[model samples]
Target: MILHIDMDAFYASIEQRDHPEYRGKPVIVGGGNGRGVVSAASYEAREYGVHSAMPGRRAGQLCPHGIFVKGRHSHYAAVGRQVREIFSRYTPLVQPLSLDEAFLDVSGTLRLFGDAETIGRRIKAEIAEELELPASVGVAPRKFIAKIASDIDKPNGFVVVREDEIHSFLDPLPVERVWGVGKVGARRLHQLGFRTIADIRRYDESLLKSKLGAWGAHLWRLANGIDEREVIPDRNAKQISHERTFSEDQSDFEFLHSVVCFLCEQTAMRLRRHGRKAKSVGLKYRREDFRTFSKSKVLETPTDETAVIIRVATELLATMRQTEPRPVRLIGVSLSALVGADAPTQMSLFDDPGYVQAERRVDRVMDQLADRLGDSRIYRAGSHDWRKRPRE
Candidate 1:
């Protein structure tokens, strides 16, 4: 059996939990800038048609009186860790889809835990007691049905699908409910008279393959609940990146450099938090016209040092300056080729030992300070004095 647990309005819930006055009211969590999109919407705000991915301005229009809070990602991550710890007690097979949702295979433990329904109830109860937040759980024989079932009764609800009920439960669901159906897929399915899972299941397999290519054949299997993906553990990330879209495009080099330093610091903090190091550093820039450019350099050794990343990113920016200087819209820093910190280091003879040692010491001090205080409590020196220019 598989159990799917999804936290209800995770980011907004955290905001409400931290601020008692925000309870029982519409809340949106995201950047306060006009260019920002809604990252999470509370159930109250969702009633007003506010949702994630909606433009922040549009969300404000939807709920004029809604409380908009700037996002605190570190807080959300802390809550996510607490949730993951709770899930770990039930089973070690937890596969987190994101910070707020995960899948757990509990087939072997059914006998020990009574039944799948009881397990779901216990998980929900544990989350509520430990975190003071509500969650929805779904239990089924397969991951596909379990994931969908979890969403059926959201906000502190549970649903259990018996083996015999899978077909009937899926039959009436819209094609969009299937795993791979996005707006494009839904439109195509609509044109093919396949409005529901049942319709797709009844369609000729060859015709589906011919019409939708490989995706159609894949969807045919999913419509019949034939997913075989396992509840994978240890889904270690391959890269860590941080990007910020400015509220207004500008040609200010000092301000853009400060932002790049801030992004590099954020990326390095994440790498240290995960006890990982990167072998490559990269920078991304978006011009006012939305044309994006990126440059990367392979480091002589893996590192999780902010200064080193910033130095390389600054070098990349110098190269970019050789071309026309258009107003900057966005800046990003990324670290890839990740490996565990405990892994052996392969350093070249030409590498500067003094610089490497200084970077390591700086990283350790920064990491300690961040762990004791908070990520935002400390930032790059240049970023501390950055001032946004007024719109023209």
Candidate 2:
């Protein structure tokens, strides 16, 4: 069986656990300023309609007494490692979706560990006992259903869907419950008189394919509980990327540029940590209407330098902007075509050795400072100011 485990309010819960006085109070992480977006919200704060990715200004209006805290990405990453270690104890066939959630296939270990339900319960209990954090778990024969089951009842929820109970469990749920069905996609589905998963299941697959192209057929299959995806373990890292969806659509050139710069910085940090360099860098742009575009640049030299990546990324972004200066809802940066850091460099004789060495030294120092303090404490100048400024 497949098991999906997700931490409950990971960032805010960590803040509350570390700060004794903040327990049971409304706690919101990130969104320290008007322009900032919330990273996470505790259940206490969620009662007032606060949530992640909501604009800080709106969150403040909703939860007037909400306690706002800056996010410490480095600290959170450390805690996430501990959580994964607990998962590793149970099974090696584990796949992490993010820092706060993962999937584990226990088919091999079921004979030794008991059924999927028992293993899920024990893992959940271990996390609570060891980390003092709440986790919701879901077990099913398929990946999509398992993920959906985990989220059905959150904040310490546990759900199990037997092979025979998949349809009964999924039928009544809203169309949005299906993965990749965002607000825009949901609205489109609803407009077509499809309000629930069952509605999609009852529709003609050929018609769906004709109307929505490949996505329609994809949704139809998922609605019928036909997901065949496996839990893929990240044993060998292939690509590194980071993306952000804003609380509101952003159009300002400078703000969006800063966002790219920040993402490139994060992507580069991971690349260096993995002892890798990239031969290609790419950018993903999603408009407010949910249309997406991508651009990539091939580099002559593979280097894990934030400056080089962002320079290539900005040029790509400018080209995309020229094509269509539409409001953006999401932006991302990625580095691929990875090679080991020890790989020989193909540098021109005119290339300055002094400058290259200086850049590497700077990256090492920044990474060290980030580890010693937190990612929130250290950042390049290009990304510092716009994160907190109100959109004009």
Candidate 3:
């Protein structure tokens, strides 16, 4: 069986745990700054609709009395490590989805650790007793269903779905519970009269495919509990991204474009360090009111060059701005569909070989300078000191 373990309000809960006075009160980590974005919200804060990735200003508006604490990313990472250590005691087949969530396949460990439910209960008890953190666990025969079962009830929840009980358990739930069915997809599903998983299950898969394409067929199978994905241990990084939240909302396109350029450089640097080249570039834009938009483009050829990444990301940013034209709370750049930098790839017929060689030489020199003088001391001229620019 598979067990999905998700920590409850991880960052905010850590703050509350350490600061006894914060208990039972609204706590918003990465809040209090007008330009910042919330990293996590405690259960108390969540009552007012505060959540991770929300603008700090908006979180304050929702929970006026919320306790705002700056995030300690390194410390949280340490805590996450401790949690993983606990998971390691029970099963080596643990696959981490994030610091706060993981999947463990215990089909082989049943002889030593009891059934999946018992092992899950034990793990939850250990986290509470040792770390004073709450977790929700879901036990199922499949991965996606296990994830859904874990989230059905949260903030100290546990649910198990037997092989025989899968359909009855999944039928009544909204289609949104299926992975990849985000707000836009949910709306499309609703438009097609798919309100529940059962609705998707009853509909013809080919018809669903006709409406939603390949994704529709995928969702249809998930609705019928046919996920074939295994709990892969130590999954490689599938994406790399960096983002910056301003001290205040920003509306200046020139300034925003510069920030995107800087972020793209940072992302590209990391991509090169990982010995990978990206086949896709993406932009993440969060508005002052907290609405977020994302756009991405697949490259004609994979690249780890900052120039190519910045150009694509900037184009996407321009596209997003044309539609929204609003003050941005946060902006980010991401690289994905990564392949080894040394991997065989199709060379562009129109490639300027001299330009490519020169760009690589510049990148190598810049990387060396960054290593010796620190990233803060070295930056491309086009990406000015936007972080130090006074908020408007």
Candidate 4:
């Protein structure tokens, strides 16, 4: 059996938990500026048609008096760790879908825990007691059904689909509820007169394949409640990247370089924390009109050193420079081609300069402090002015 746990309005809930005054009111968490988009919306805000990815200005138009708060990812991560700990008590086979959702294989522990439904209830209860947040749980014989069941009753709710009820429960659901069906996929399904999972199941497999290619065949199987995916554990990431959308388009080279340096340091710190090294560094920039460009270089040696990553990133950025300056709307840095610490290494004859080494040491100190005190606790000297000035 598989159990899917999904936290309800995770970010907004955290805000409400910390600030008692925000509870049961419309709240949106994201950029406070009028141009920013909503990162997460409370249930009250959702009732007003506000949701994640909606423009902050549009969200405000939907719920004029809605409270808005900037996201604190470090706080959310702390809560996520607490939730993971609670999940560990139930089964070690927990596979996190995100910081707020995960799938657990409880088939092996059924004898000890009684059944999937019982396990789901216990997990939900523990999360509520420990984190003081609401969660919804869905349990079924397969991952797809389990995920769907969990969404049926949300916000401190639990639902279980017995082996025999899988087909009946899934048949009536809209095609959008299927695993692979997004807006475009659903629209195609709708055009084919397949509005529900049962409709898709009624079509011939060959017809589905002919119409949608491999994806159609896969959707047919999913509609019939047949998911062969295993609940694999220890899914290590292949790359780590961070990007920030500026509140206003910027053309300042010094400011852009600072943001890139900070991102490089952040990615390098994450790689080192995972005991991994990267052989490639990449940079991405988006113009004011949203045209994006990226460049990457394969390093001669794999490294998790911040100074090396930042140097390579700076070099990559230089190649994209043009005579006509354009304002940047977003900036990003990423490291890829990862290898474990136990892997073999080749030494470089030319070592980094003293100043580069010093910068790396400073990055290490900042990383430790950020990990303990939080990301906002430390900032690059000039990056502070990128945002608004404080009243005090």
> In model 4, what lDDT does residue 164 have?
91
lDDT of 4 by residue, 1-392 (tens): 99999999998999998999999999898745665567789998899998986767778788888998988777888899899898888788887776799999988888998888888888888888878899999999899888888888877778889889978998888999987455555666788899888998888999988877766788889988889987765336667788776656788787787778778767887777678889999998866544568889998878877778888997777677663368877789999898886666565667656755687588778877765554554666544543222210
Flag regions of model 2 displaced more than 4 Å.
Answer: 30-38, 53-61, 67-74, 244-256, 286-293, 320-331, 348-350, 369-378, 381-386, 389-392
Candidate No. with top lDDT: 2
What would the per-residue lDDT of candidate 3 be over residues 51-113, giving only the tens digit for each residue?
987877888888899999977766787799999999999988888876799999998889998
As a TM-score, model 3 comes out at 0.69
How would the candidate models be sorted by lDDT, starting from the highest?
2, 3, 1, 4
lDDT of 2 by residue, 191-254 (tens): 8899999999989999988877767888999999999888877545567889877757788888
TM-score against native, each model: 0.67, 0.83, 0.69, 0.70
As a whole number from 0 to 100, the lDDT of residue 109 in candidate 1 is: 82
Residue-level lDDT for 228 in candidate 4: 93
On the 0 to 100 scale, the lDDT of residue 377 in model 1 is 52
User: Considering summed lDDT, which 10 consecutive residues are worst modelled in model 4?
Assistant: 383-392
Ranking 1 against 3 by lDDT, winner: 3
Best by TM-score: 2
Supply candidate 2's per-residue lDDT for 192: 86
lDDT tens digits by residue: candidate 1, 1-392? 89999999998998898899999999998634554567789999999998886777888788889999987776787899999998888787888776799998887787888787888899899888878898999998888889889988888778988989988999999998886455555776898899999999888888988877666788888888788887876436678888876656767787778887888888887778778899999988766544568889999888777887889988887777567478876678889999998867776787798988887888788777765544555666856534222221
